[model samples]
Target: MKDSFDDPPPVPPSERASLPDGLRFAFGTLTVLPARITRWDRPAARTGMACAPVAGLAVGLLAAVPGVLLLLLGGGPLLAAAVTVAVPAALTRGLHLDGLADTADGLGSAKPADAALRIMKQSDIGPFGVIALLIVLLVQTAALADVYADSWVRGALATVAAAVAGRLAMTLASREGVPAARPEGLGAAVAGVVPSRAAVAVTALVTAAAALAALPLGLPTALQYAASVLAALAAAEMLLRRCVRRFGGVTGDVFGALCEVAGTTALVLLALG
Candidate 1:
């Protein structure tokens, strides 16, 4: 065996400027960018899911800028919503949509837990996935129409908040000390490095920020928005816990499911507001 001193000293944070292309590729593909930095440091449970909220925040900001600009420029509500939705889709390369589809397929399946997992691993989409995606798009579009028509600034804030919070919930779901059904996958890798405390801290911080920003919508509206996001997060955590119990852990498809469910739940809550 080589001596311990033979290895080079650990890389300092200041010198960690350019990451390996594979690191960026892994992170970009997952759409969990913040977790990318964490992956480099301790590459286990926290990496995959953690980066998601950070990426979602960045993507949300990118989408919000255009929506705000279009609204300021006198563009119609539909145009603004279109821009908001399109930009996020482009950023994550429609990965969430695939998750939405897979989740639908799995949930709609009457098969056993293992069978549902098997179906999720398939690359092809089923009728359930198709129907679910269409309905999700319809509901989100309608909600955006209402939100934008009411107040463009509020609409932008809510959109950004939902994106960030949804991913935050997914990260939280990953911390239950369970292994995914599969032997090797990004989801399993992420679950390994994620510290339970970090998940709580991040979720709390984002929740506080989102509630504060929703104030412009009015105290009642802000409370409603906060309640809605929390409800979604709670539901997701319950579902993830159940899935872990049933299947023994969360997979890439499960992570996707969590994100889609969380996002949809948040949007529906905004609509309720």
Candidate 2:
């Protein structure tokens, strides 16, 4: 599928020019590969918002590719889980993870939003960030370790679904009143146009399908997985609303945090089941 995250080859000049002005601008970021798809322009913002669900779907599929490859390699469950982590690292070049680390350092310091956001922008990671990253990674590693050991394919699917659903939460956060931390930052553009209800429905539907799909293949309890996704979404919504009230809206850092939180929630629920 020609999804947004595939990073397709550049469109021909004639085709690019022929697109409606809105689409040209909406997809302009594709030409730049990993560049921010959203800009301050209204057309781009709305279009970018509309495209986020597709982005989630594409990214999820891409992340799953590695896990399947590992399974084919006869790798054990732990190795298969590791491949799941590696896939996102390669696809995003660790950008979201960096956001996770930075946000941890900044938020853990208990500073005001402006000051904390400034800290996050610093090149160096602080002790808090490092510790937080370690804990989050450890949780993921452990959860996948168990899942893969039991059912490699189920573990792989869970990982992919979590990645997709988590980002949807982050994207939904951007739909509210939050302004980007930086005037020209990537998060600013995309965050502003987030479609809250649409994001919720899309994520829920995808996650539900993932849960059901896994059932025929010995995945975790379907009810538990469904509940986990719902809980994660609820938690993210509450957190995003708080952030909006406190700091004005979701930033890239918050988005990263949302991903981590949602992913962890899914894993925890799966474990309990």
Candidate 3:
């Protein structure tokens, strides 16, 4: 039998280059992308949600690769858009999509909070979830297609902005006042974890980065990027409010819904831009 003496020695954090724990948790929880975090430190996990935008930026960049490749190959815009939409889902194992569907089901049930939450917890998809997922995906794809049709440059920027917006929505939804609907799980771990000041700072940085990215396109386009981000944040606010009112607090599914809605809204707005 294995003995306690056989256990490996613990590696000190000093041996590492001050690896960002918040970033680790962000990547671990937000995407299936490769990020090494040797230890599952609880304190780090608590702050990780704040770094979700960084993960989202990675997701956006990777997701854009498919469309960018297709464009470089002279493929149809619709196909490129479809590929872009599929890449993030593929990378993340569709967890966010599943969450979006579940949250929709819960909210659409129109039942009391307990019954609604129970519906959300079920492994099966309800009619509302199915319809919501389908509609959101369709809208996002169509928007992306339109953007790609315009130019790959515009499309890429929009995709990145949308991706960042989605994570930013997750951050906003998890702010200090947002309560967890349940006593355990993701909601318990992340909801209300972000300080309001931190949220504002992170959001401002994201917005500034997005603006800088849009500068190459034009000042008007940069304004559009800002608008797109705002639209996403607004959608997230609505989703968060609904979750709070209906479920009495935030849930993991609610966070998922915020990401989807935020991403879709950002894409649509950017397409218009």
Indicate which candidate wins on TM-score.
Answer: 3
Instruction: List clash counts for every candidate, in order.
Output: 11, 2, 0
lDDT of prediction 1:
0.69
lDDT of 3 by residue, 149-168 (tens): 99998888788888889999
lDDT per residue, candidate 1, 1-82, as tens digits? 2222243344456533233432453356556444333333334234445555766677778878888889899998888887
Worst 10 residues of 2 by lDDT: 29-38
lDDT of every model, 2 decimals: 0.69, 0.63, 0.85
Better of 1 and 2 by TM-score: 1
List the candidate 3 regions with Cα displacement exceeding 4 Å.
1-19, 36-42
Where is model 2 more than 4 Å wrong at Cα?
1-40, 179-182, 215-220
| TM-score winner between candidates 2 and 3 | 3
Question: What is the per-residue lDDT of model 2 for residues 159-232, given as tens digits with 9 covering 90 to 100?
Answer: 76676567657656656344666665666766655344545555667667766866775544776667777877
Clashing pairs in 3: none
lDDT of 3 at 74: 86
Q: What is the TM-score of each candidate against the true structure?
A: 0.80, 0.76, 0.91
